[model samples]
Target: MFDNLVADFERPCALDIKLCRYYHGQCEDEHKRKKLEQKSNNSTSLSLGFRICGMQVYHPETGKLEKYNKYFGMSINDNQAVEVLRTFFGNSSNTNLHNISNTVRNIHTAILNQTDFVFLSISLFFFYDCKKTDVTPSIQKTDIDDQNVQAGFKVRLIDFEKAIASSDNKIHQLPQRIKDNINYGMVNLANIIDSFVIEK
Candidate 1:
């Protein structure tokens, strides 16, 4: 199902590399398409390709294939992904509701816009600095502007063995099956976001 989503979103000409080349003819459908890709060489958009179901199609932007490095996608489904996120964020104060909602909405929007490849499973990474509770002397006012504290979030879609190539169509309505799965995934995600409670 995820494969179908990705196929619908990505243009054949957009992917940076035809990851099928790495399969050495072992991959079924995706591998066959590599032949068609050979006829054209205009695609240059850097793409991570697909990696689910133990199948890997990795293409680094640096043009160096790092087979040794771990690929990012985890094998969890939508429900599990939501659970993991809830556990990480723990409980939040009502004041943080807006931020939590915005985070979910942003994720949903990004997924909807990504028509290139279906993501079998998605992974979330939370990065933040340790809270500095110890009181420190405040430096006197200076001309230098300080960089904001660093905490970032990222989403990774993995798994593409079932991926199929399709045309990109942002304006057109998707088939019912695809729409159903997307809606289901979003609902689960929303439930997780709603679970956050304002810490008293």
Candidate 2:
């Protein structure tokens, strides 16, 4: 089931190797782990974008791909994005709040950076693990003796195949309309993250 597309080769190749390592019990530091989660999520979008641009996805280990957060789950619908964000970060205690906030900020940064290209529509997909988290309405206050619990996050944009450059040569520059849309998206994303964090 592995179809090799010209443009999608690099990202999937790199990501698949890393994922294979992770699955085989290669542990990574927190920061690198967070970054790798983000990268793995984005690799799916890159794959779709390449296909939209007429490149095929090189299929390798379809079963493994289907098992990762990247391929197995459904896309977060517009209405669900906010709820998903809330659930993903809502249950963390104060100590974990900082890391969760950092993850949200990182996601915002990634979205802003990637959406520089014109896009007709974009959606974020949540990780299966994050989706499984129990989001209680009220999180108990952090106790001094409590052990640190860091919940990893994975969220990335999709449906970029409809995306295109505003101009043939100006691939890096997006038009005003696209910029406005991206700004709006980021604002909503930030609001969702803020709604979940219990202010200390």
Task: Go through the candidates in order and give the C-alpha RMSD of each one to the true structure.
Answer: 15.6, 16.8
Q: How do the residues 1-200 of candidate 1 rate in per-residue lDDT, one tens digit apiece? A: 23332333211111111122112213368756685343222211011221112211223233222221122223343344344444334323343443444454565566566676543223322222113222222322222111111121112223334343345353134444433233344444445556665332
Could you give candidate 2's per-residue lDDT for residues 17-123 as a string of tens digits? Answer: 11010111123687777765454344422222211111112223241321224332224333443343343344355545554344445544654566345554444
Q: lDDT of candidate 1?
A: 0.32
Predicted structure 2: lDDT: 0.36
What are the TM-scores, per candidate, against the unseen true structure? 0.35, 0.37
Model 2 regions more than 4 Å off: 1-89, 95-98, 111-116, 128-152, 169-175
lDDT score at residue 164, model 2, on the 0-100 scale: 58
lDDT of each: 0.32, 0.36
Candidate 1: residue 120 lDDT (0-100): 28
In angstroms, give how far residue 59 of model 1 lies from its true place. 38
